[model samples]
Target: MTIRRALISVSDKTGIVEFSRQLAEQGVQIISTGGTFSLLEKEGVPVTGISDVTGFPEILDGRVKTLHPAVHSGLLAVRDDEEHQKAMKELGLDYIDLVVVNLYPFAQTIAKPDVTYEDAIENIDIGGPTMLRSAAKNHAFVTVVVDAADYGAVLDEIKAQGDTTLETRKRLAAKVFRHTGSYDALISDYLSKQVGEPLPERYTVTYEKVQDLRYGENPHQKAAFYRKPLAASGNITTAEQLHGKELSYNNINDANAALAVLKEFDEPAVVAVKHMNPCGVGIGTNIHEAYQKAYAADPTSIFGGIVAANRTIDAATAALLSEIFLEIIIAPDFAPEALEILTRKKNIRLLKLGEFTSAAERKPEWLVTSVDGGMLVQESDVHTISADDLKVVTNRKPTDEELKQLLFGWKVVKHVKSNAILLAKDDMTIGVGAGQMNRVGAARIAIEQAGEKSQGSVLASDAFFPMGDTLELAAKAGITAVIQPGGSVRDEESIAVANANNIAMVFTGVRHFKH
Candidate 1:
């Protein structure tokens, strides 16, 4: 299969002209359609139009341009078959030796704020994908190129080898299939919104492979980084460390978790995370004090935890942070002096996220977990329950301080696993019982840890009380009030138990199931 003819059609014409010129210089005839052909012709590159090759006009506003049997027959024909050559000769079809095609900007079109359904539909390429799939299917005979960045490499290969090898063609075909699959997934996800129903099949997600990390949680397991398709620029994947060793899998995960939690606060804030959970979080007038208070919350947990700051890290904050043996630190900016002092840690990761904030953006889909042979997917419990949203089920309304503690407990409980309980007072978590089999056991653990502090502290449950056992435990622990989403069928029993204990209880009408 000598590369005598090639088809080039692309939406992103970044280096197409230079590439086409090089192809023409190599005596390879260029075949293109519409915009691509006009651009090549204007750039003084010889090109044959699709109408001349297919012997049919591009009708229906260019929708029915390249979806012809002649075009596909040329691409799909077997080079080794004598019958294929006879048929091609009879039909006056020229063999398409190479195909350089890229789809329309469907993803970018829908990303526009003012995008309309018609506009998105127009961007969905029918002919381009047809050409790509056709060429990709016959990789043994056709060289398929999808990305513009591959033009230089493809040209070099053609120059060096006279034609792309079968192995390279097969690899390029694999890339084409992956590209089309990702494109189709984006289209399906968007169309699902028009029809008010969950997708009948699995919700498809597309992520570009970013980098292969050293290892996963342990040094033995293999790991890699994948960036989501629609993620904004300057995210962790695109961040430059400037100094320090390459990030580990655990370091990247913890850093992202810390960033996610810290970005929620509008004020200057710092959060330290360990094992995918926030161990310490604090907000102050300045980042330095915030970091100090966050580190002081639990120095043991902050030992190798990931620290994230909402504001730039100054020299003062860096000096204080330098003393701690942290794994990673993420922030919008860092002073030059601060970075110099921090980089001395060698193995510590210093990620600069720049001044990018996506706090108000709609949360990405749901959290998914996989067990043995099945998977569970649900919306993330990042939802906040405000005081005004709570219902005073009992006769006694909560005091201002009690309401604040209850809200604080509610927030903390959402971060814990199901069957969770948290006790809070004076804007601090006193005790927490997370991931227990029984609700009563979780309640007891929270109360016991709170000790005499439970006398004035408030308790928050992730789910409704099943019986009076948890209520009785809270009463004995001297809990002042309790907050939970009321959904249990035995609501009367729980309410009666709360009233008898003389503890104020509020029904949030919203559940915060963390698991």
Candidate 2:
């Protein structure tokens, strides 16, 4: 197919002028719409307007410009079909050999904090996607380009072969559908949220690739990172890496876990995560003391784990952190001396995140996971419980200090995987046992990890105890109080055991099963 006339329309004008100039130099006639026509003409590239080609002026605020039969027939015509060619000639319709188009910035517009529905609706591109779909449907004859990144390659192919190859056209056509699919998905998602339909009849989500990691949980698995189009700030995806090698799959997961746990505390706090579980968490008067308490929680598990701090890391804390072999350290900011000290360990990944906020304040609308042959989507678990929400289920009520410790343990337990158990005293975590096959197994591990520290400490279970075994185990370990969601059918048995052991227990009426 020889190129004669090409249509160009785009929202992002990156590299378009140069690309149009190259096309003009190749003796290809350029027909563009509105701003693209003006831009090309201003750049000294000869261009024809859509009004000249279709004999129709843009009307209705430019919404009715390219929806004419002249544009669609030209793009949809089959070149080799004699009947289609004859109909095109009879109607004086000229074949458009190529289409360059991109949709309006609808995602970017809606991402603003104060955008209105009227503002968002006007930014939706109608003519662009229509022309793209028409050209893609007839890719055997009409070439379509949707991405700015593909401009140079398309221009090079045109310069080399006078027209793009069939294979290239097919690939570009496929890209057009994928691009528009994501575009429509964003619109659907936004409108669904606007209408108070969180989970729509047909849920759709789209993400742009952020980066390809070195590997997944294991080196044998391939993996990459992607982010939602309008994802909020102050998340692991938006964090800035100040130093060290590229983050691995495990590094990103652990970093996110560390951040989630760090957000639970408003005071100066430190959280260390290993295998996506909070192994150590502490709140203190200063970042240094927090680091000390967190390191004291479980020193062995802190090795090679990711650490996050709610407050600025000071020189003293950095000095202590550098003593350990950590995979990553993330904080809102670092003191000058702290940065200087931590930078000495060249291989450790250092991240400087801005002001941290709890995910509950600005939660993601959906949480999606892949299973077998489909996806499972649900709202994020941003549910929080206060001390007042605790319902005493045993004869012995928790003391004021025990209630505080139970709340602290509950916060830490939420981030741990099911079957999860966390033991805490004061405002620090003493032990975390996560991802066990059974609740009692997890309880045993947490108790064993706490050792002598388990005395008088509080325990938090992510979900209800299936039987009295976990309660018996906690009582044997000297756990004076326990907090858990109480919905199990064997709840009475667990409560009986708690009362028998003279241990105080509270039911949160909510569960935090992370898995």
The TM-score that candidate 1 achieves is 0.88
- What stretches of model 1 exceed 4 Å from their correct place? 232-243, 335-341, 354-364, 368-375, 393-396, 440-455, 467-479, 488-502
Tell me the alpha-carbon RMSD of every candidate. Answer: 3.2, 1.9
Clash total of candidate 1: 0
lDDT of each: 0.82, 0.91
What tens-digit string does per-residue lDDT give for candidate 1 at 216-267? 9998899998877776654577777866678889888777667766656667
Q: What is the lDDT of candidate 2?
A: 0.91
Q: What value does the lDDT take at residue 250 in candidate 1?
A: 86
lDDT of 1: 0.82
Candidate 1 local Cα displacement, residue 455, angstroms: 6.0
**Tens digit of per-residue lDDT, candidate 2, span 1-515:** 78889999988999999999999999899999988888998999999999998899999989999999899999999999999999999989989999999989999999898999999999999999999999999999998999989988888988998999999999999999989999999999888888999887888889898999889999999999998888666678888898888999999988988888887777788999998888899988898999988999999999999999988888989999999999999998889999999999889998988875663464545789899998999876667778889999899999999998898888789999999999999689997889999999999999999999999999999999999999999888998999999999999999999999999999999989888
Worst 10 residues of 1 by lDDT: 357-366
The true-versus-predicted C-alpha distance at residue 145 of model 2, in Å, is: 1.7
